[model samples]
Target chain A: MTTEHGAVKTGDVVARVEDLHVHFSVSRSAPVRAVDGVSLEVRRGETLGLVGESGSGKSTTGLALLRLVDATGGRVEVGGQDVTDWSRRRVRSLRRRVSMVFQDPAASLDPRLTVGASITEPLIVHDLAASRDARRSRVAELLEMVGLRADMADRRPHEMSGGQKQRVGIARALAGEPDLIVLDEPIASLDLSVQAQIMNLLRGLQEQLGLTYLFISHDLAAVEHMSDRVAVMYLGRIVETGTPEQIYRNPAHPYTAALLSAVPTADPEAERRRRRITLHGDVPSPVNPPSGCRFRTRCPAARDNCATTDPELYEVEPGHRAACLYAVEAVEEMRAGAATTP
Target chain B: MSEPVLSIENLSVSFSSRRGVARVVDGVDWEVHPGQTLAVVGESGSGKSMTVLAATGLSPRGAKVGGTVRLRGEDLGAMSEVERRRARGRHVGFVYQDPMTSLNPVMPVGRQVTEASEEHLGLRGDDARSRAVELLDMVGIPSPEQRVDNYPHQFSGGMRQRVVIAMALANDPELLIADEATTALDVTTQAQILELVESLQERLGTAVVWITHDLGVVAGIADQVAVMYGGRILEHGTVDHIFGSPGHPYTQALLAARPQPGVRADRLATIPGAPPVPHQLPPGCAFYPRCPVRGDERCRTEEPPLTEIAPGHRVRTFYRAPHSGIERPAS
Candidate 1:
């Protein structure tokens, strides 16, 4: 099925980001480079997962995509239109094409209004519907679309569960019929079972609506589950980008490998035999990041070249890219070790 | 295994408000022997933290707590209020998820940690200060002596949490209650804290009641696992039993819902309904509405008692494996 608005069909680029940079300036300190020279693309009908630590700039990249946060330098193209330095009116118009689902649905939702009113408010703001009855029916349809009961429209935000509130949030984002949806930590605050339900709902909604999602989260496994392509970010830079199989099994970058390796497996025997790469130090402040590579301080494969040269993301294999100078060598050793293990 | 370091029986906690009286924890019987870690896994409002709080006499105001909490054969519930307070730090150490709130921002990290040693062990002055430095060093805090003088805000988040762990270990208590200790930290920091706790547990042989929602961490660290649903223990057994061959339908669904690395599925397996709130819980099984394999009518009308499936494995339900075929035959 085609989306309500726009002609963005399957296999087309919904959002394109090139060398994007977002910096927060304080009076007495150096600018915090939250997102530094990162580039990615989200194709129509696909979920592109952006993953990193708290200060790794994944959220900032999502905000930049939605025009919620301003970019310092670079181009952001949403639905074949540039949104980097657009006027206020243009950005307001762009809002209809791209909507965002916030991390905490409870905090994002206005408790004073019922969920149905909350969902319908977007329709009125965007003038998507002609009349009140039409908007109410549209909200009901959206509630059912996210697997919520139609009777739940009258309940306040506090009356619903976390998963149900998130469904409302998804329904609100879908109200404008956005071609690209920036989902920021969608299922981070949910229970394991409810998280599964929400993830499944999200995937099913994407399939049904033909929506493209720039999914940003810190959860590696959940990101891998929802993403068609995964980008690993570290201290404001994209360290690696690849398909889930390439990123998870044969990670090229040391940061990516360490991030994946640190995840404690659920299988008891597998956890016992797993080789852990424990990164020693905390993430450095974004205000005064490292000179070249921000991850050099904690990277075990770091050498003299890391401090001097900021490596650009180079294609190590077909369609898989990494920014580490020792990407090939590090991944080769990991593969060799895995191959000889059994 | 050695004798049980901490034993709790028939523990239940309820809070009364204008809304109503809600029983948060219900009739839980658990024991942690020395050098054993019992992970209480549950989601929000599942009474995981309340179980530990009631045992330690830290329940909130207007809350009624009933149970017997024994520490090394001594009944803490029978003890006087002051005696219980003394038993808390000297015998039981508590670690919470948020370190910033646990530690005093204005006080030096040294004084906060040393305060435990001073009050519990009665070591004062230079002795307490030196012991604080040693505890900090034991928890892998670099430059222990210098950092000891620094306040909590001076340290990084991971460092502050390490200081909290240091303080938790200051008295070298036999039982440690860590409620989502690493939940607030980043993944890398979480790995470091887990390693620290594992090493400290090895050296100290502290019986730990580690409460968390992450199944992966439970598999990595705990010796035994207790799966809690609506403030009730749905299943309890060895980690191997819980992970390898789960018995309860709730436990089976939780394990399946979790997304693990290197495992892929077109869609995640999900329990269909939400967990019942404490106040609105049904008279029978709280998970019956969501249990895919619930086949028996008795599950909706009669509350299942905790029945032993193996020597140590127990499940609080009567849906035998073969009776239900929808999902893993009730398991």
Candidate 2:
């Protein structure tokens, strides 16, 4: 259940989820398995990118770490402390160690509050600042840290651009000085030009503060760029996990390969010659997912065994693992093919 | 050369509000011939969508449209409302970003697909249903005969999009306008939709005007690329020309900004500022504020005209071309 690969010596674990599950009960039917048996680790000062489509439970897993949603099963540990059984009042104190930045900055930030007030609220809530002047000074520092002008504190959310609003959201998140920050699709709404600015800012912040991030997004390219390690989620399960180089270069899982193949490159020449592995149909409903393998219904390499036996995270390399029965075979064949090619 | 399927000449669209008159699409000109896919790439408020909307006579209320839009060499502006509607029904098809909004939840998917055919092709009852089944099958829907009766809610997002695409193709329009059609779907689903559209275009020879902010999608599916900013096309050329040697700095910056899946960079290149607001646009180039390689005084004072640098490739810039070191000033 721990899913700690033997050779993954990536420093101390800042945050982790072991066999976590979150279910939402509907009226007359079974509960929706939003996050079913997902286990992951965020190493100290390193980013772990979670990539998936809508309803893949990537968000739910992140929420479980923050205790925003109650876990139905398994354990969630933050800073090496198991907090899965913690109550709401107890979880309030946990805010100092773990925080979240949501996707829509417009929706997250209050319209009535100034940028300074919004960031200051966190400082006051956590009792990080003693006086009003201290809170103001801290707010200014946070603003400058996120590449925004200190004068921006006086402005409201509507006065700022999408990228600027997101920066404020980041500033608010950093006010608590948390060890782990869950960035849920932080740059999805920004323009192409602005997205890069935010991504660079996040990377710089992570390095300067030695922070750990559980970056969740549907954008594969952004994930590969920002993350030290990548995890592919499918139907509320972590299907594969590896370093970006290992996963992007040579993926073991059929779902991972298909996802990678589907992302079109910016270079037209490369795109023209590329062979895409298109998956058929759509992601299965989470209410009643496929019996054995969640992805077998749409996977190209799925066989008879895939439909009967639930696959575990099979080791493909020292630090790379995939939840597919034939992943080991696929990885070996891929390496062989690579060796034979020029 | 064959005649263009759709053509717009110096088209400008403006909306007057309490604040001021904002020119959303300013003197834009583009032509899409049969079997050609022209991608209009830009960020929000870049007017890529407005250009097509105004050209197709589908601009929102209170919009003041100027210049000429021709469909199959016939002037759309000169036509009456009914005539324009008839022309649009017969010639143009659209697919928006969200399939759910495009489709009605209560109606059967078959009736929706058959609506266009019945209205335009004069098909009735059994004939219309049969045509809907064919369209669904063509769009790669399995068991199209049975799935045709399913409502929009019954199908998944990807399948619902397929149904919408089938609806768009019901009339076999000569021109297809897909505005961010794959933006809402996942990458895998997006790939499937892109492939379906490509294959359908090959068989039907329908011209496509794909409007999206994603340069990667543009690079993959486009024959021609037009990079729009501040309601004006900063760069326009064939995909090879645009991707290989982007003449404009904005185009260059956008390409650098995207994080390529396989390629790793220490830090992604960033554009300094936000996009220009339409009503408060600068006196000079719209991108002048954020232009990393702006030229002397002229680039900050005078707007650059669209100048032809090579055959079929035009760029609007005052400075020398990016990477080429060739000075092709606005003329």
Candidate 3:
């Protein structure tokens, strides 16, 4: 490691995961490793984007952090305190400091409850505000903070548009004054114009409140636009971790490179000129992921060693790391080679 | 080109809701030539889905459909419900957004495919089952014989989509309407699906009308692109023409809105506000409120018709006229 840990140490760490593993019983002899042996940290006032394909353990890792799902093995530390084996009462207390925004806002919000009630329920549950007047004032403030009219809060979830509902969900997550929020594909369901609005809202709120976010998504472009740092996940493991610029411009892992290329470019001329690194085969079952590097099956640079020995995440550049032996060597080779062609 | 495999002219679809009479699709004109992909690109509720749904006579009850839809020179507007139903499966295939909903959850994958084949082609028993397996194999589903018996829930998302494709191709219709087919899939699976659609179109010579909001999906696959905004075709032209020399401000804004990978632009050029609803559309240009180049007073009062900008490219915008101050690039 390059010891850029010093830079990360300067900031207050809001959430940290140590060797988290979440497994589900698939059959009598098999267990699906939804999230296996993952370790990460989210700093206060920072956005950590979790990028991955479906069945890649990205969502499971987010859920594990919130204790929404049972963790098979792991230590979840929020605000420098370990809540790994907390009592039910302690867990409820910890939830006040942390909140989560689900993928589909329409599905997440209670259809029967009005938007105002849905948002204020968290405040009531956490006992953050005692009086009805206090709760109502807080709800109105949250709605205004998320760029929604306070008057519309009386409407039910079905009455509002998709973007409006998502804003309400964000308002609900913010009600508890959380230090960290887990956003799982928050803007995936919204249209492009609405997605931009949500992204801007989230960015503005982060700056204003100094809140941390564990942003999970499959869209690389959106991830790059929002996150300060990103961790690429595959088969329940963090395959690569780097800043947004590093991940997009100089991808160290083959899977990351392929994923970056897979996102379609808006510039037609550039789109035609760029060569996409199309991967073969579908994502393998989490129950029986391939040995060693789980992405080796679809990795274009996979070698014989990739099948036997699992690569440890090593720093290819300052603060940029990848779990691929070949990636490190490839980076060295590219460094040695001259600027021969465009 | 020869007569289009599917031609829709002046098509208007209206629905009587409790609110009022909502004109979802208004005076739309579109065509699909054999082996060509015509992409109908628009945001949700822009009438893209309703327009196509009306074309196959599959609109919901009480939906009023007008204008002429000619498939192989036969008028679909004049056809009876029963005749339209028979013509739909035999001559036109439809692929919905959610394959899980389109495919039966209880029925086996093979049986579902065979049902479409048997219903449209009258193949029965062993022949239908054999054709179903062949269709599965054609769609690149592995182990067609054993995997065919698996239920919809048993298959993965991509595999389930493949099964849906097989069912769509069972009748081998001349025209295929894929409404947001790859929207639910991931990037890699989406690329595969697009490639499959392209290769199959080449082999079968079937014209495809792909409806989606994702510009990337239409980038390489579509031969012709029709940009719809506020229930109107704002721009229609060859893919290269639209991508390189867009005429309408709405189309330009859409192109600028999408963020490209590896390109770190400071801010995305966004057209603020959502598309207006069918009943609440503004006078003249429905996009005037969000149009970046809205200047002339006529744009606020006079509705522009689809005027030819090039040999093939057409745009419905008063801002792109001869002396409208917006210079047209040499075609």
Candidate 3 pairs with clashing backbones: none
Say which candidate scores most in DockQ.
2
TM-score of each: 0.95, 0.96, 0.92
Superposed Cα deviation of residue B273, candidate 1 (Å): 1.6
> Which portions of model 2 miss their true places by more than 4 Å?
A7-11, A331-342, B324-331
- CAPRI level of candidate 2: medium
Query: DockQ of all candidates, in order?
Result: 0.64, 0.65, 0.40
Give candidates' CA RMSD values in order: 4.0, 3.5, 3.9
Q: Candidate 1 versus the native: TM-score?
A: 0.95
Model 1 misplaced stretches (Cα beyond 4 Å)? A1-11, A332-342, B322-331
Q: For candidate 3, write residues B58-83 as lDDT tens digits.
A: 88889898989998889987888788
Candidate 1 lDDT, B1-331, residue by residue in tens = 6778988899999987777888899999999999889999998889999999998889988889998989898999889999989988798888899998899989999999979777778899999888888989998888898988999988988899899988888888999899999887788889989988988998999889999999889989999999998999999998888888788988888887877566678799899878888877787888888888886789998899999999899999888443311222232
Report every candidate's CA lDDT.
0.86, 0.90, 0.84
Which has the better DockQ: candidate 1, or candidate 3? 1
User: Which candidate leads the pack in TM-score?
Assistant: 2
What is the Cα-based lDDT of residue B4 in candidate 3?
Answer: 93
